[model samples]
Target: MKFPIAALLLCLAVSGASAEATYGAPPSGLADHLARLKRAYPDVILDYDKTKLTLKSGATIPISDGRRDKSFDELLDEPDIDDMFAFPYPAHAKPAAPAFNADPGRVRVESLFREIYGDCRQGAAALKMRRVPWFGGSVLITTRQGVDKALEAVSRDLEKLPKAMQKYLAPSAGTFNCRAIAGTTRLSTHAYGASIDLNTDFANYWRWSKAGKDRKVTWTNRIPAEIVDVFERHGFIWGGRWYHFDTMHFEYRPELLAR
Candidate 1:
């Protein structure tokens, strides 16, 4: 069957499972993803075409590197803008067991983020930080794309939950840290100030668990659905949803939740 590119991309964007296999190829299904990026960061993304994405700052990034055989590690470490949508974010859906390597929103394009949020290594990302009230205290988040406001909204909705849920939230593990993902040199979303880690006491990380001969870490989640729901409602994608789960983490990535 044949489907127009626009309609097909829209389906991929809103569907619970992303069109990971279909959209990863360069210039193949780029339009819809680009549209979502524009919508997700309307103030920043200027325009896009089959080959490149242009930002408000007049910087252009190749939509894809034209490599179709990138290993998962390569996808994570050297992704192009198109690879960012390689996995679909199941926003508002019940938390289910992620398929092996189904870590959506983890394959980030470093250059694109550095362009959008500024490079942390150069102290550029820090310059964009603004404090947003969380629980009783405050956390520093990027003011760009109104992420600070989004976190504020998440806080307002979280406060409406019962008091018992408070323990998993207050004293956030941290936010706006200028560092790379533990072992990798790639800048973490944290370095961009667009992510927040909730209370680590209730957190469960894949790395903390010892995998058996099959090398699969058992999926465990301590954070309640009620809490996860609020963050997604405000454009945050939870790390708990990843196969490499980190239940306490959530990052702003609305492009992955265009529905």
Candidate 2:
């Protein structure tokens, strides 16, 4: 069967770009994907400059030029349309990581998320919350922007797995919290209630790895593909995919998954 024109273009784009990070390269089928999105939500596309993603409904999302280190807040809040691919999500599973730093969905500018998901510290914002039974037990999470629905989809799907596979999920480490990332004032995805962490025991974080002579941290992950696949299908990105890996974390961000 023939793939969509966009999918073909995307494959070409990915092939042309270095394979280190999934989102590091420009989206090959971006034009096609955008066309599809326009068809699905005509109201969202208004007009466009060469690099701007304009919505007819009055929102303009910019595309990054793939040049510099945008701050976490900048990437999350004012990211260029291109920045959406900062981390590469697995288009199809292969045995290895995409390539060095091929993290297409990793970028997030704080203000952007705060605009859509709301701040968790403000009790009123995260109030529109609900619970999903995680591995047969309940856990509270934000319902903003259909996040609750997405996570529920994840839960329902995970429930079908064999009982042994299910054991790693239960006793979930956590779901919604107002906290800064370790050692950084920058707010975490958790602060938006869009993230979740699984059992700590089976997880591996880059920080836990030994530092080099230069003191830079090395990346590593132990989370199984079986688990990552389940989360990705439901709009969650795996922390295990990061160069600075945090194997236990997952968060909802479909814009990153548009590829």
Candidate 3:
């Protein structure tokens, strides 16, 4: 079964145990997967023809470096351009424990991010950072790709949420940090000033919980679906949807939201 190349419905959800058991596997059709990305960030990515992805800046990146037979550790430790889309991001869905190893939107290629956002550690990413007004104070975020504007819209909408939900949002855990992801050498999207973590008091991290001998992570979340829906509505992807969930995290990934 082939989807229309132009329609390219990129997001597909798997429920029950399938979400965990086979979530890491790549989507069956690569062409459609890449097409969805092309449609999502038209300004940044001009085209993707399976072999390579071309940026508007005239730079070309190989879609697949052809390092096959990757181990699960390899996917987490190092993923190429195509691997980033191995798992589909479940937009507009209620938070659930992701199927085993179903960490979508997490396997980012650093060079790809640095190319667009610039290196935050060297002041490039930070240089593009701007302040956006939030609940009570303004938050620092990148102005690139309309991120700061999107966040502003999100802030305004979040303010309309019930007063009880504000606690999960206020006094944010910090954004625009140029630091490596905890337990990994790779810099996170937050380092690019494109991601934010909500109130830590209501957050849940897989690492915070003790891992079983088999490493079956116990998933938990305090943030509500209403909050997640607002973030998705404004072009942010929630970390709570990933199998290796981070309940308080949300990042600007318009490519995944282009659908």
Best by TM-score: 1
Compose the digit string of candidate 3's lDDT tens values, residues 1-259.
4766434544332232233332234456677778876765676787778588889888888887676656666776777777888887888877788988788788888877876777877875444888887778778998887889889989888889899999999788988888899998989888988888999999999999888976788899999999999999988999999878898999988667655
Q: Give all TM-scores, in the order shown.
A: 0.87, 0.72, 0.86
lDDT of 2 at 174: 91
Give the clashing residue pairs of candidate 1, or none: none
- Residue-level error in angstroms, candidate 3, position 167: 0.4
Clashing pairs in 3: 19-99, 20-99, 20-100
Evaluated at residue 110, the lDDT of candidate 2 is: 58
lDDT of 1 by residue, 214-253 (tens): 5578899989999999999889999999988999999999
Name the 10 consecutive residues with the lowest summed lDDT in model 3: 14-23
Model with the higher TM-score, candidate 2 or 3: 3
Provide C-alpha RMSD values for all models, in order. 10.3, 11.8, 10.7
Compose the digit string of candidate 2's lDDT tens values, residues 78-188.
Answer: 455556655546633632544544555566655446656677778735547788778767877877767788888988887787777765676788988888888667678
Candidate 1 error regions (>4 Å): 1-30, 124-126
Clash number for each model:
0, 36, 3
List lDDT for all candidates, in order: 0.84, 0.66, 0.81
Measured on C-alpha atoms, candidate 2 has an lDDT of 0.66
- Name the weakest run of 10 consecutive residues (lDDT summed) in model 1: 16-25
Which candidate leads the pack in lDDT? Answer: 1
